[model samples]
Target chain A: MDVSQELADYAAKHTTQVLERSQPVQVDMGLLAAFDNTPIDPSEYSSDLDAHLLQLTLTSTQALISALFALPTTPSAEHGPVIRPPVPSTILPREKPLPKPKEPTKWERFAQAKGISHKKRDKKEWDEERQEWVARWGRDGKNKQKEEEWATPVKAGMEADQDPAATARAERKARTAKNEKQHRSNLAQAAASSSASSRRTAQQARAADLERSMLVSKSATASMGKFDKSIEGEPKSRGVKRKFDENVPKAGWKGEKEGLLGVLKSVESGLGRKEKRKGETKEGEVVVRKAVRYHDREERLKAGRGGAGGGRGRGGARGRGRK
Target chain B: MRPLTDEETKAVFEKLANFIGKNLVHLIDRDEDDAYCFRLHKDRVYYLPLSMLHLATSIARPNLVSVGTCFGKFSKSGKFKLGVTSLDWLAKYAKYKVWIKPAGELPFLYGNHVVKAHLGRITEDTPEHQGVVVYNMADVPLGFGVTARSTLDTRKLDPMGIIVFHQADVGEFLRDEDTMF
Candidate 1:
């Protein structure tokens, strides 16, 4: 009993001494980083640097592991267990610069110069007659209320044939078209003003257009550029590469059979425009032929009855012709 | 020769269907032992059996004269033109037929259109502008052509009036011998 009591007393003394000298490792689970802020003993470090580093790393890693286990975890079917990481304390730099503010439109610039303050308007407006909130524009909007109305008062000088509702719709459409035109012009102005990026994009577009024109001009020649003189440092022109089915298809017999059948189906459908036109003409001819046959029969009967004796030669010729 | 592209196949099929109608299916969907396919070699379309195609694949494109029946060829402008070489296949499945008299046989073989004076028997109810295989009185297929007028309309036409417009005739085999594959 004295021997067991002595061993327990020694264990308690060693643990207490270690706890007093060492500090808890600081762990940031979000970053998966651990820091050992405890001071290192110069004597122990100098005596065996490798041993000292190993001891320090072991303690810090053990502390981090214990800290990870302390966090609340949820049972996950796929991952077995999952823990939510805390927000990282360290701030990282942005990858790209902040976007530039949009330029003011022509109307906005004019209003600003004229010292006009803009008042925000609600999309929905109160309709007293309907006792409901209706949209200012779009889906049962007030703009189209005149056109949708059951009756509209005709103006004194207006023509009887002129519809006020149709006029109102046309006016609204014109207004929308004008607004769209103005918006496009404003966008063009903005693009022109933004020189740096816009200029680079414009240059790239111009290069692409030049390339396309060059290809077209080259092909326009009688020899299709074959006899054209080569320019210094000119990139070689490349036509579309031809692709063919595999000499021996990897899919084996079934794919080849299906492809052939598919082609046959398209053919039976008369996919070509020329073939379709011919089919149409064929149908038209049948109707015209029937009419012509009726006309011929009528003429033959008339001739036979009018000149029965003289028509004998023609009738004989017809009989012989039938053979 | 490579397998015909879908567009090329469509062109060839559209041309063939004009003569054979829906019977084009028999040429594609056949028994496993006798499966045939379409292959394009030097602009000319060839209809060869699968086993023959495998054997012909070993020969170089220039060395391979032809495989199976030379159905037709695609022109420089991509239009498919049926040739006399496909007359055998066209004759077998022709939906409508136009028979010429023995007197007109020589002229038809000489690549002339069958005239009303030489017309013999035509398929009853044959529509105008329909593709019909030309046959002699003995039921021998001479060539194929399109009808200028329907069966009823032909009765009112003058004896010298054209009845059938010549398309591809057997005469092409000898006339176009140099280019006929």
Candidate 2:
């Protein structure tokens, strides 16, 4: 009738259905195997399978309802409709309050606080504090403790612990002396080498400077000669005229005239005599005159022929005559 | 040699303007007398002037012959056929197409031909409502077609302008001549 009663009834019915459906089916393994082998179409068997499933579900629902109804119901807490005895409270008593933290001192707070600026302490004060701290933990303090423990000296063959500070001081003193001696020696060697190197460099610089000057002078001399030659070769009308005048002969007195006249004169008379011979025969003279005329004519004809041939050949050969 | 018809010229100009507008990274308008300046999403502004469109058409017409080989020529009789579909593809297809940087320093290869004239800065005179980049024929790199400056400031003389006639201009500037010293 009430909402709670309705919910309980529905839950009981639903549980009974689920329990009844869960019951195992009595499937024949051999028959199922044979059915699997036959491989019936899913659609063909779906309706039949659906009917069986529906029956199984209904049976499951009935069985589930019976099982749920068999269980006893507990009374609701809020309702308090059916109370037997008052139950004891299970919660434990509250714990004691934790102790409050101590407040920090001004100095401690300042140190702990982030990004706080502090006035710089004097170096002397810092040094004093540092010295006090060092004294407490220094090698001397440690050695003193060792001395007290070993005051009853080692018996017979047992070796004693060496004082580390003394050994260290002695070793440092020896090393410092050796290093100082080597440093002075190295300084002397470096100074000697440096002076030598500087002297050598200076000498090389002088040689290079000298060589450069020599090269400059040589080039200057060469350039001066070149300048003179260029000056002589440069175009100048007056110089050209003078050189031409010296090289050329007088136009009227041709080279051919001089040579021919000299040769003719020499042939006419015996080498020394300039005049004609006294024994001149008229017949011989006439014959000589005829011969000279014939020879002159022959030479003229030969000259004309050569000129004509050259002109004809040149005209015919034109472009082909280069080779 | 004859001037193109007004209708024909306008059509050509529109084609080139559309191509350049789509391809180029528009720079800022440095003019006082411009009507509408476009500001590209990138910091540059483009000043579109009627005069620039005309110049772009004139330069682009001569290159059309080459454009035709790839994208068939426009019908003499008016017909609805698109020119080269893609400027990027046309650049690769065309043998003599020139690539130019519309602004900033001209590559060293351009030398004197690379014009370096300052167009005025963007101000009250040039109101950039629509994002556009302003570029001039001078800004185009060597071998690229020339376009008119949208701004009137460059209508007169620009002294810093250098025109490199050929690739050799850069070599001449570099002076590859051997020196004894």
Candidate 3:
């Protein structure tokens, strides 16, 4: 046979075998078990099986391709060259050009533009509204309107005629002067009242001291009466000397000697000791003793005089001093 | 100074043994014989063992008579070279002592033998009972130098033996006794 015929025969046979093998088939259980367990003997199989398989695969692929090619083909509609739909001229007007987006409205444009002299520009407006100057032009419309309503207008001619801020300055100066005058007056009044109150307080304190001293004298007199009674009740031996000593005021005593003899004796003893100590010139020993004795006698005499005066005054002052 | 109690001695020995086990690279055996020898590399841990011993002795040595003798040169110059024999002589002079006690229950006899062999190699020249012979890198005498170098370089030493994270108290124990030495 020719080479193509032989190839065709081989392909037909291999395809039939492959188709047969591909179909679901019942297996001989014993044969399958033998084949599964035993290793295949390569020599047992024909080497031509591979070539036959290759031929069968090629034939099947070619048959599929031929079948596909032989099938019908539908012609696509030839709608000429593809053309996009024309955009409406009105959709994108050539002339209007969206007005360059309106240069972003006046306020936006003004905000976007930088480096403006915010202070210099607002000075005139500030002078008019004084406090609400910043709100005059740039603030919200509502606030601007409110500011305008509240704002007082000054005619240029009138502003020039008047000294502009002369009245305000004069008014401020007058108010300050008035406040200073009132403050000075208040300070003077406060100082005078304080001094008067201080003088009154000093006088009251002196009066209280006088009252306290009077009370002390009365109490002392009462204590002296108790002392006299105690001295009298003592036994004669003890009493005589005690009464004599008591009549003669003790050194540093702070009470009165009632009788004339008691005062005369005290004065005699005070003078005698002073002259004796003065005439006997001794060192520290005599000097110190004499000085101490002199101080003691002087203190006693002063106390005696004070007690006598206080005793006499006590009776009269007691009734009046109660309040 | 009072001799360490049995428990304290055991604790110290165990710590030292663990350290040797971690740091020594060519460790022939461990916990084997009564003695152990650790073969150390020229690395940080090698320096560590000797540095630790030096620090411990400096801080803990009872007398001020102790001396330190590094066997090799501090620098490459042979001027610093104190031959091994000289180091041995210095060790004798210092009368340095070394001891090790293992931690936990003792392992097998083989383990003990291995530990002893390892220690023997390190303390080969010096008498085990008299002087210390810690396995350390000849290049880096103190662990501090190696550790510092490693830290600066951001590299790990990757030492061979068991590494023990010493407690802070150990630092207290290792404080220098200026008055002592």
Candidate 4:
């Protein structure tokens, strides 16, 4: 009887059970998340926030581990045991807004108006003569069967020069070209309808440019629009009227004359500077006169003129040359 | 008719400078009473004096056949081509001159290029491809052309080698009489 308290304490310490919560913890093994929806006691929470949060987290973790263990396990060759998480039950919020629907094409609108439902077609078709299935289109497709045949019969009333194979191939190509043209028109219609205001302004700008070009061409005749054939109800093409300086302005012609001189100055400065330099010598360059005089003296000395009386002989020779 | 725009003025000046060289300054800077200006009328450029410009203002653009000396006309492609009418201005201020013999005068007037056999004399130190005024033995300005060879280079040319390339000649006045205006 006295060992009851000690036995209880020993059992509490040895047991593997986690602290219990007022309400059960919700576990989602797929998301590995647990929700504690139980109300908290103010006294316990206020007494110690760390202990209270720690106890709450431990309880939720214990619930999650138990739920994970309950899942059906399979033995893997590499791993000892493996458990597959089930699909999540919670509907999480999306991060982005829903995508916009694409604009319907031309043919789609026409089909909707006509209440036509789309029917899926098989890619391969059975060829009765070949006894095999062939692609409806693309490489070696059934569409080219007539052109690929060995003996193609000429249709009645056909031209003698017309080739059956060539005609068949041309017809196939024409069909594709027609489809491509229709697809382009569909895209254009979609683009136009999507931005109505912007497209309208663009069309107006193009129309104005076309009108201006037409006016310019109309006036481009040899007679300067005078002898050009006039179109009925066509608006008169107003040319850019020539604007000239007043023949007799209040200000005298001195101002205009000055302006003209200014232009001439600029032109001359651009051209004459380099040409003038071609005739003039550069600054700080020595004259070659002394070199020429030295050469002359050497020539005189070489002409049998001695050293002592060379000056007097040079003077007498100069006097003779002058005479 | 209106005064030439600056771009048109520059174009005309550059073309004029090809023959006249620095003498272009004399054309623009003149006596106050003898001041002149350039005007564009129906693609043709006119070099008219101030007094004449004042008188011609009364005539309507379409009625005014011509205002002053028709120095040159702009082509359909906007390139300026000197007319034979501007020979007076070019000859007066020509920097380089080429004189042709009397026999070659007729051929040159007929728009033939000046050949070595026809070349009488050329300006000394004239560079290749320089614009030169063609003259006759009597010093009469026959036309204008671009030189094919410099003065020194011409000495090496054969008798039949071209000396100057024909550009514009006075013969155009008679040949192109209809569109000369």
| Candidate 2: tens digits of C-alpha lDDT, residues B1-119 | 11222343334323333224322212112233432211111111122332443343454433422211111123547321222222232232222222234452344343334343432
**Model 4 regions lying over 4 Å from their true place:** A1-244, A247-250, A272-323
lDDT of 4 by residue, A199-259 (tens): 5757788987887887889888888788878888666667588676755545876776666
- Per-residue lDDT tens digits for candidate 3, residues A213-291, read 6545544775643454333333322123311222113431223212222333444455456446444543334566667
lDDT score, candidate 4, position B135:
95
Q: Which parts of model 2 have CA positions greater than 4 angstroms off?
A: A1-192, A195-201, A222-323, B1-181
The whole-model lDDT of each prediction reads: 0.84, 0.36, 0.34, 0.84
Highest TM-score model number: 1
User: What value does DockQ give for candidate 3?
Assistant: 0.01
* Segments in model 3 whose C-alpha atoms lie over 4 Å from true places: A1-60, A69-323, B1-181
- Residue pairs clashing in model 4 are none
* Tens-place lDDT digits, model 1, residues B1-181: 8887778878888888888888888888888898888888899998888898889879987898888988988999999999888999999999999999999999999989999999999998777778899999999899999999988788889999999999988888789888675
Best candidate (score: DockQ):
1
> What lDDT does model 4 reach?
0.84
Q: Count clashing residue pairs in model 4.
A: 0
Order of models, best TM-score first = 1, 4, 2, 3
TM-score of each: 0.46, 0.12, 0.12, 0.43
After superposition, which runs of candidate 1 have C-alpha atoms over 4 Å from their true positions? A1-234, A270-323
